[model samples]
Target: MNSNHPPTPRTLPTAAAADVPTFGCVVYISTLPDGRKKGRVANLDGIEHTAGTEREVLQRIVPVFKKRVSECLAAGDSVPWIDPILEIDPQEQKRFLPVHL
Candidate 1:
């Protein structure tokens, strides 16, 4: 399998993305085995930023994401309105919201 793309094409509702002019793309954050936090926003052209914490990694990716988007637009590429999607995995539903059932 090509490592260039993610295992799955994560997505979100178009309306949700349209609501925010600058849609929140999928920034996959994971805890590295070394204990350092890694934040990767593939929609931003395969960018992967690592820092001590998720917050710090986010701080680093924001500006970069904006810059890459701007460049894509300037180059006449379609607005990456759909690339970086905000999707919630079913398995992670509990982590996001607990249900009393």
Candidate 2:
């Protein structure tokens, strides 16, 4: 992770459906100094999952992200989307995932 350069975004695989509403989600995974991996979703505040590995963190966060999106939709609140590029930290790795709810 070079602090001088932005991390390249990687797209995660997803199953598609023409009728399902899909939203673009940016997930940032970073390694802490203490060796823990932390995952966070862009535009979503105070929601983070930390684990011993990247896969574990991601697995833990995705369901929560989906649930939040579902809740917002059911409540008639607009789900916020932010450009992941603008939120990028050079030290963190990013994943672009299509979230279907």
In terms of TM-score, the best-performing candidate is 2
lDDT for residue 70 in candidate 2, whole number 0-100:
88
lDDT of 1 by residue, 3-98 (tens): 897798778766543332444455767777888887766444566689998789877877777777667767989755544344534322111111
Write model 2 residue lDDT over 27-96, tens digit each, in one string: 8889999999998887676568899998998788878888888898999998665544347688889887
Which residue pairs in candidate 1 have backbone atoms (N, alpha carbon, C) closer than 3 angstroms, thus clashing? none
Q: Tell me the spans in candidate 1 whose CA falls farther than 4 Å from its real position.
A: 1-20, 80-101
State the local distance difference test value for candidate 1. Answer: 0.60
TM-scores, one per candidate: 0.54, 0.70
Name the TM-score of candidate 1.
Answer: 0.54
| Model 1 weakest lDDT span, ten residues long | 92-101
> In model 2, which residue pairs have backbone atoms overlapping below 3 Å?
none
Q: How many residue pairs clash in each candidate at the backbone level?
A: 0, 0
CA lDDT, every prediction?
0.60, 0.80
